[model samples]
Target: MTEKTAGKSLGVVGLAVFLSAALGYPVLIVAGRGLNPADGAVFLAFWGVVFGIGSALSPIEQEVSRLSAHADLRGGRVGPTALRTVAVAVIAVGVLGAVLALPPVAERIYSADDISLGLIALASSVAFALQFGTRGVLIGFREVKPYGGLLVTEAGVRILLLCALLVLGVTGLLPISVSVALGSFAFLPFLVKARKHVDFVGDAEPWSVVARRTLLLMLSAGLTASVLTGYPAVAKFFAAKEDLDALGSLFFALSLARVPLLLLSPVQAMAVPTVVRLLQDEDGHRRLVSLLIRGTLAAFVLAGLGGLAGWLIGPWGVRLLFGDQHVVAGWAVAGLVWSSVLLGAVLLLAAVLVARKQPGRVLLTWAVVAAMSVLVLAFTPGDMVLRSVFGLVVAPTVGVFVALGLVVRAGSRDTSVTG
Candidate 1:
């Protein structure tokens, strides 16, 4: 895409991200207030699993976006490739469903016998795949307006459904959970509209290549989500039984601290394409280096400010929103916010590595971070909240460094092609 076109896409997508972020809070607020502490804790764990899987499976979107953009450049159709991707995603979801259906896994994750949640989880997976696949198509074709609309629709419908449930006094876990799951499916109208786009029409990569690369991307995304979207659920496994009840506060604080990520998510969706476009430019390497330096600086500055705010306001913020039942210490809030900022930076760097076609490096980076976090969570001694905070703060710090190193090395060897 031309620089002017890129700028326009950024503006539209940025606005949509803003709207999505704003609309999203009501859903969280309602969820926090409507459920008692124990139920809220259970629901938060459920929320983490659903979103974590969605985030983990986001590679479908990323791969499709990358493939679609390259296909467009080659004057080829990515429609068939997109279809194959959906099939692979379906198969993956089937496996995921089976695992989640296990009594052991379901009992721990859901903390309730509600069989409906299992069904909702499966359905949500399908919706997540379709949602990401459709989004990939729009993004590949540079359909920013439609892309932006999809974002708003998903968030707006979620808030509306959740709020409606609240108004009806149906704040039980099942109803609210279903309401949350429906947000992924709210993109149906947008999907129909997406079908009319010309980009999904021609021949592209072989299925084997797509599947292999997609699996690698999925692995990387899964590890990343374990910390970002899935952390609460993952934490439940390692956290002492006594600490689990109190996790409601930590999870709430973490969610609030992650607001910036929600707002910045749309930008992340565009990261691979933006980096790919840069890689295709004549003076790409130097430009990529400059971008990395600036991005690192920006991440630190923004994180520093966010940490300060969390330290001062986050303690009272959760209390005000969810009552005294949930209260995270200010230091923990600040640390979580800092971790999120670093995680965002790591994601951007991973995009650069992906654009360079270095999936192994990306996978390796997240693996290290994930392992580090899990070890800390398992072995660290302290209050559960502090332990959680330390693990989160340390993991992403490692990811940013590892990913940056990988990106730099990849750039040094070859910036113009898959290395």
Candidate 2:
């Protein structure tokens, strides 16, 4: 089992690095164009929405699947039904956002948008939410090749579209946003084709029961999203009030630092179903949990080494990727990477909790973290970099450690009960 798990982990890791390179390079190029501090903030805000919605929807889908399984609904039908519901909700939100109420909200959040960025953000949000929910179905079915392929293809198409727009001198948030929506559209056919392989197209269970469970799951998932994406926005609040240049540097550093986490995502993706199955058997659960803790610790040590290397060589990398003018963002980049390692560990714990059906606990932990982040950002002063590092990194790191301890204790209690 260990050997098989290791082999699977290696394969997923390889796929992650491949996709990241394919996707990351183009994103870096697009990001390079936004050297202005305001542009940097906008870019971060766009991703904040995209990833925030994605993260928020993740565990909701998990809950949907769990409920569907319990109710004996077909896998194929369960996903499509939930996705259709979310897709409609997303579109409704977009349409409602067209009102003047949005600009004020954007302004309050320091995310001033021309009509184009707003519309683009709106469209991107719906597309992202739909794609994410469907992708969850694919993962639940264990259709990994198609799942990974869709991701790589989506990233490829996005890059192509973005590059085409840039070459035409139509570089702004609108075109990129449209490109994101289009890229999402490109994945629909693949999802349709993938759905044929899974049994997801039959009659679903009762909608009322499913809706009730999904809402609870949404709250949990939404809180997780807050920690992942809300932290950046919270940091942005403090960032905007301080030195703009420092804010830009922090954003750039943090963005670059996230690449390693992206590279590690496939591991977590595969880990989820694997852990879920392991938890069904007593000895298997114990073995799986032990391995996960050890594996996460090992990954962290490696990430720490990589972060140190980035700290040492990051300025040169930044210069090469962005420009010599942006070299000073390296230290923050290194710090951000180290923070991601911490975040990655927290994520692994979250996944374990989900597998154990304890997502509410995970949600509560994120609530505390998000609240702490807001407080720290609101109170901190001095350079934006220092403020951001403290609020986003220091506070979350503390929260994650506390969350990890709780999860470990919970797992132990669960084992005792089952034993």
Candidate 3:
């Protein structure tokens, strides 16, 4: 019965992850097929900023909900006071994003046309916050199926609209931006579903404690999320117009390489709740150690298999999907695939850390990674496009090491105590 319950839970999570990734993978393929290289660069760049904002808000969304649900299960709740705090935090972030999207600031991040679309995309960040916040509530309430459905609906709307635009020959940043904004609202229906979950976190910890923790996590983990989503834009800024096509092609390859993340993202929603629950039990640490080890192994295996697949057909894929200008070197594709494997491991490790209530380690990991990436972009003298791509490949190794160290330390700590 225990094994069966675990299996059923695994099956449900697996379904959600794959289903969430469905539209995303296809969207990348369709965009590659339809958009010109330069436009692809614009689209990818705009995507970085918008999604970065969304990712930034995700800590609040996922944590608040997970905590809310966890509290409820423990005879506590987040309550009206904390919920209001969440609201205030959302508004504050939204304002900041809006200000950053203004003309002067926008120019720093994008071309004039791209800036226009970037602003529109930024507008969608509010919707993103609302959607994710609600999702956290649903997650906390253990409405897993509904939570997963909302995930699919949000992504589905964007991809369907993008496909329609592609069919009509509207392959540019504007179409992409509009699709993002529209799709963000697709989760409105789920907000109501989450209402009961958010009603009152009974006997929960102090709102101040949760608020402080949420803010800290948002700053640390959010920064990492921002870098992952925003690097393409930053890379584009460093690249000359002559190099746009190459950057675009590299990004196209990156999108495919990161297909694993798309699959793992929703699956990770279960991580916090599961880890938190497990950690409270007598065998919590052992269970967490086992899960982390196996998950990391699985991530590495997938990386190897995915890398081999990429090496074989990656160049052919680029040419077929995005024309000859999009040809990626086989070695580069292989490196990126392995890097993605590292990335998946990093994400898993991050969840482990989060579950253990240690976000500082996650921040340290990203700080090192972000510094390396920025230095490479700013000072690595070479073809701008090539250098940026190299940085992307190298940065994940740092995460791998840091995550490995934490895993070992955690295991040792648990063993010393248990033994």
Candidate 4:
């Protein structure tokens, strides 16, 4: 049992991830049908902003988890370091939320009386910051059950709250949105329960160095979040007024296409350890390249199949699941699906880069892909669906090429891999 900690933890956490992701679809559907088209779109946009903020702050969790694990291995304490980091992260996110709540931004994102909504967003951001931090502490200590419990707890809380609101005949956008923010507090129970037993003692790094590394991670993650979780908010900003009505359908299609990403994104974490092991070998570079080449080929084939299915049944499926108001074109759905799979491929390559300790390349990959994708969305001469398709497709395609180029260049430096 002791020897199986890694595998067991991963299995538990993986199931938790799957369940949390699976719950998201139903939550989206309930929210979509619960509100009118315009309100549903607004809710989604708000959802994106809040969750995007959370995603941007996710690096703290990663950093803390890594630090905690290293600290435990070294027989040090990480409690003080983790607490300080969490404090900084929460404060930073709070400031960001405040900026978003400023009259101009708030008005655009929420109702005319947007103070309440903005406050909700701010609260949610802080909650998510703490949630991530706590989970990091749990997982870093190899407390997989606790970590998994937190994930399920948060999802369950959100869904139950949403259902309760609906049952009580409260379907207002603001009210519905509260469920999301409040759900993040699910970590509190777990945190309190294990506080005394948890060992947070760990060696501390210099504050400046820690801060710098965290900022870089946040920047890279922010870019990725802007492309993934934040795209809905992007669409709301760039879309023409006439196309606004169809925003619900566009968002619905986007969510459906992203279902695969939820499952595949976790693969990046799994790949990191494997890649690190490979890097220790004499012919590691060659082996890594060969492995990725095969993986890329598999990604392409799977993406092609997913795209075809999206083209064939994507529209019908959305209509059946979300209703006529959420109708989108098949080709656009196909593009979205294809883009998602490609992004998964990019994630795999990113794992390699991360394992190789090449932060610069990782940022470069996201930078190029994210910028180009936004540019395509903003300037493409077409309807919303066409623009979205082009934008989504451009992200992962460009990302794949850029990441591959970087990987190959890195491989070139190794004597084991002659190009």
Candidate 5:
């Protein structure tokens, strides 16, 4: 893509993200209020299910699109049946995992708050999966407008629906669950509209090849999800039951801190297909990589500055946005915010790996982070100080180091074409 085109794409993505973030804060405050200490655990558990399933399915979508584009560019064809079948299987696994995991865990490990949040998670996972699947197709085609529109639509609808539900006294677990499910399916209309702009239909390919590729994608996606979401979940696991409230508060703070990173997700989203296409041309690939790194660095620096500001004024911000009840989470929020800055930088490395189709390297890097996260949590004392120290400070710093190492190693590898 031309620099001008890329700049336009970036601008669109940034606008979409900023809009989502602006809308998200109020919605999160409302949602967070609906969550009590008991409900928080269930919410986290539910989130775990959502993340697990969503993660597993993500790679399938990414790989399918990547492979499909590769095939198309090389004058080859991919069977639509093969693609749809793999997608169906992925959906099946995700649905099954959510159903099984949510019910049992909610009954056993979760508090009342967790129970409600868990239900919402279960419902939302389906939506998350579908949105992600469609997004992959859009990215593969380098359709930035639809991709940005879809995100804006999802976030906007979810917020509106959540507000409407709250007004209707449907703020309980069951209602929240229904709302989540509705939100997940709400993108169908948009996807349907966007579908006409791209082609995903064709004859079926052999099931064996489809199945194998899908499985690899699933594994890679799952590992990536685990690394991303597992940190908070693991922190909760290490925390005491009575201290669940504080932990939940910390998780909320962390989520808030991640807002900036979440807003910039569209950058990475747009980068994937662009980078993939550029890989075919040596100079283009280098330029694309350089642009992505520079953008990532700039984003990280901004997030860090935001984090510093949050540290200085986080309590006031928390009080103003989420109310005084949640103000105790301020310090944790500040710490987690800075941590997100580090993690955002790490995503650049991840984007590079994705562009290169080096899922194995991505998997290995996350595995190391996961191991270190577990080790840190295991050794830390069960207190707010320890949790904050480990979860906020140590874990993210270690992940940044690991991500940097991967980026360096990836940089060192020969970039010659191999097909």
Candidate 6:
């Protein structure tokens, strides 16, 4: 992909992500108003699982596209082997979701009474995993427009269905759960043309090589995602019922913080394909460095603006939208906004590292950050909200420095390599 096309693809995908959020945020707002504080917490806790599951499984889509994109750059066809491999990864994620919902394991993460929601969450998860793989193929093919369409299809379907359900006076967990599970099936239409492919066994890259990369990215994606969405689960497990409302606020703000990060994720994901293709140019590493500097500046500028907005308006907005009863800790919102800012930088760094075939650098960054997240959560003693704020704030502070060091190292290494 040329630099011009790369910028355009990033814009299109990022806009689609924003539009999806616009369509879906109303449902969340209505739920916050309609449900009582306690029920809203319960609802959010389950809703968190739905999204968290999707986040965990997204590596298959990313890695599939990454591998296929390299092949495309090399003037080779993306074989069915990549597709078939992604299918297994999707299935494995489904099984992992199921296993986590089992009695003993489930007890550790979520309340057992949520078992029915857990089961429904599993179905939603599988559907989303499948959806992600299909979308991944489009990305690998560099089918940017179609990729944006698939994103719209699911979120659009959910909004329409959810609106209908609200009009029918259906409220509570059932509507949200049902809408999400069904919305994920919108990925079906995009998959129709993806299936009719013959494997070029002669041109086939070894599955093990592809699988190794896939596995590495999968673990990296999963860990990075856990750092993003796993906190609600931690709060669900360890936080007292009295602390649930504050946890609810944390989750809600985290979801808001997620918007820019999720929007940024597609841009980051596109980098592996786009940047690798750019490496063929004589000034490739220069182009790569320029991309990194631009991306970092863009990410920070947006994050700073977002944090400023959140600091100014987030508390009032949270209550107004979700409900007066829903707790909104102003500082927590600020902290989360900045945390997500740091996360955006981490994501861009990871994408560049992956494009450089330095997934290990990205992997180590996430491992250390994930550990920081865990340690802060485990050792802290205070109000749940303060603990959450502290943990969320501190980990990402650690992340930004770690990410910067690795990014610089990778850039220096690439300079030597290309020279």
Q: What overall lDDT goes with each candidate model?
A: 0.80, 0.61, 0.71, 0.80, 0.60, 0.72
What are the RMSD figures for all models against the true structure?
A: 3.5, 5.0, 4.5, 2.9, 5.0, 4.3
Residue pairs clashing in model 3 are 65-136, 76-202, 77-201, 77-202, 78-201, 79-201
Cα RMSD for predicted model 6: 4.3
Which regions in candidate 3 have their CA more than 4 angstroms from the true location? 1-10, 70-78, 167-169, 200-211, 262-309, 323-325, 407-419
Mind giving the per-residue lDDT tens digits that candidate 3 earns over 265-337?
A: 7666677787777767787777777777777677777777877888888888878766676878887787677
Q: By TM-score, who's the top model here?
A: 4
lDDT of 4 by residue, 253-349 (tens): 8888898888775777679888878778888888888888888889999999999999999999888877777778888889989988998898888
Per-residue lDDT over 1-419 for candidate 5, one digit per residue giving the tens place of the 0 to 100 score: 79999799878867875785576555557656776744554455445555566666766556556755565566554446534644665566656546544644544435433455554565566566666667666655566888778768866776878889877876664454455445556558667644653446665667777676666666656655554554455555555567666665555565566666776676667656766676667576456656655765675677568767877877666556554555444456566777677666666666666667676766666666566666766776667435554555555566666665555455433434221
Candidate 3 has an lDDT of 0.71
For residues 1-419, could you state the per-residue lDDT of candidate 1 as single tens digits? 78998888888988886887678677778877777766776677778778888887877887778767876787765667777786788678768866775666776666655556767877887788888888888888777888899989988888888768767879898888888889989779887666764344566578898788677667778898899878987776665546755787788888888877876777777888888787777778778888898889899899889899999999999889777778777888899999999988988888888778777787888999999899898899887777789999999988888888777776452644454
Best by lDDT: 4
TM for every model, in the order presented, reads 0.85, 0.77, 0.82, 0.92, 0.75, 0.82
Off by over 4 Å in 1: 1-9, 66-78, 113-115, 142-144, 196-206, 263-305, 408-413, 416-419
Ranking by lDDT: 4, 1, 6, 3, 2, 5
Worst 10 residues of 5 by lDDT: 410-419
Q: Which residue window of length 10 is worst by lDDT in model 3?
A: 410-419
- What does candidate 6 score on TM? 0.82
